[model samples]
Target: MLQLTDVAKSYPTPQGPLFVLDGIDLRLAPGESLALMGESGSGKSTLLHLAAGLDTPDRGEIVLGARALSSLDEAGRADLRRQRLGLVFQQFHLVPSLSVLDNLTLQARLADREDRDWTHHLIERLGLAGLEGRYPEQLSGGQQQRLAIGRALAPRPELLLADEPTGNLDEGAADQVLDLLRALIGESDCALLMVTHSARVAAPLDRCVHLHHGRLADRTP
Candidate 1:
């Protein structure tokens, strides 16, 4: 349940304002997964940031469910993001000091919505049943990533925004992680918007779209 309309974003440069997104429009429905594909400098991440309300667009509207992000103040946006959004980045931004269990429940705790049963279920689904006491550095890359995903999903967010979620893993690991992610998203009925450059990464999604020079084009592959 996300929508963007005539969204444009630009940043100041020495030469002039460099536009990263121009008149971009897109939508994703609840329980639907969509892959965003783009080359470097094509504004894929910018679009994600805007949708996540991490950054404000220079123009246009972003609607998440029934609320318009542009209508919210900074604090309101922050609250909305904390309560409604789940984020996964290329880098597993886990707390080094926190145990795997703590890291997994961190977001849920912060959101004041921690559920022990759901967290435990997520740990099992993510293949992280035995390493609850381990720290991020003690785990493998895939393990750490799974923990990150678990943390994001712990609160049962309405929308999940993932940027380069499998970028650091080998092909086999990537595929495994993707499968787990898809399965979990389906079970949770949370909408997914994943930003990736690989066609293979986008292949499993319900729909795929490519970004080019700040614009979006439907991509069948």
Candidate 2:
């Protein structure tokens, strides 16, 4: 469902242009789960951003299904993201003012595709049914993260891009959230590509790839 070919990205630094990702070639099939592993400055997250279309590559191409991201303008990319991509972050980016229920349905509403039954099912499956009226600040870290996951899945996206999704939670909470994420993704048949530094977190994924010095390494753990 997702493919990247010769993808490269660079940013201007005081010294010169610093390469963050170089010639990345990867493909994710429908309903497959992949984990990206790397240390600080290894460009794992950069690859994720490029794949998600949150940021464009300086060169090369990112293709989702048959549509090439480089071929689309900003507005078109935004439209594609809303309809086809579901994103989860290390930090739960929940709207503090909105209740759990509202946050879960926000993306679906934005896309004008809100299905009350679908949203309700997501909330219940994510264990947020009784807590829907609670705000982000009032929920525990795990609850908030679950709410974020519910929000991402509410849209029934074709691809899910998660960046350090368990980074902010404690061990127990992280495990719970990751398990739920895996199960939900499986049940929905959505492709997943996640960036993580923890081996424990990446272990359950179908495949794991490591990045070093902006290039994909032929290594896995």
Candidate 3:
């Protein structure tokens, strides 16, 4: 459902342009999960951003489903992202003022695709059945992360892009979150592209790839 071809990305620096990704090619099919691994400054997050349509590649094409991302204007991209892509970040970007239920349903509401039955199912599956009335600050770290995951999936997005989604949690919490995430991904049949530095985090994915010096290579294990 997602593909990138001969992608290159660079940013300006004092000396010249600093290349982040060069000649990168990758693909993920529907209901497939791929883990992207890289050291700091290796452009893992950059690749995720490009794939999510949050940023454009300097060169090469990004195709989601049948549409070319480069063919879309900013507003078009925004609309597509809102309607089809789900994003999760390390920060657990939840709205502090919104209750857990509200936060969970926010994206679905925005997309005008809210499914009460599915949202309720997610709340139960995420171990958040009793915390719907609570706010972000009122919940534990793991609870907050689970709530974030629920929000992302509430819209039933076609593709889910996660950047170090478990980065802020402890090992136990991270493991729990990953399990829940994987289960939900499977249930929804959404394609997942997750960027993580830990081998443990990438282990459960269907395929793993490493990013180094602006390119991708298959990673076994």
The CA root-mean-square deviation of candidate 1, after full C-alpha superposition on the true structure, stands at: 0.8
lDDT of 3 by residue, 1-221 (tens): 99999999999999999999999999899999999999899999999999888899999999999999999999989889889999999999999999999999999999999998999999999898888898999999999999998999999999999999999999999999999999999999999999999998899899999999999999974
TM-score of 1: 0.98
Per-prediction CA RMSD (Å): 0.8, 1.1, 0.7
> Tens-digit lDDT track for model 2 on 1-221?
99999999999999999998988999899999999899987888889888878899999989999999988998998999999999999999999999988999999888788898888778888888788888999999999999888888888899999999989999999999999999999977899999998888888899988998888864555
The order of the candidates by TM-score, greatest first, is 3, 1, 2
TM-score of each: 0.98, 0.96, 0.98
Report the poorest 10 consecutive residues by lDDT, candidate 2. 212-221
What are the lDDT scores of the predictions, listed in order?
0.93, 0.90, 0.94
lDDT of residue 194 for candidate 2: 92
Q: How many backbone clashes does candidate 3 have?
A: 0
Residue 102 lDDT (model 1): 96
Off by over 4 Å in 3: none
Show the lowest summed lDDT stretch of 10 residues, model 3: 212-221
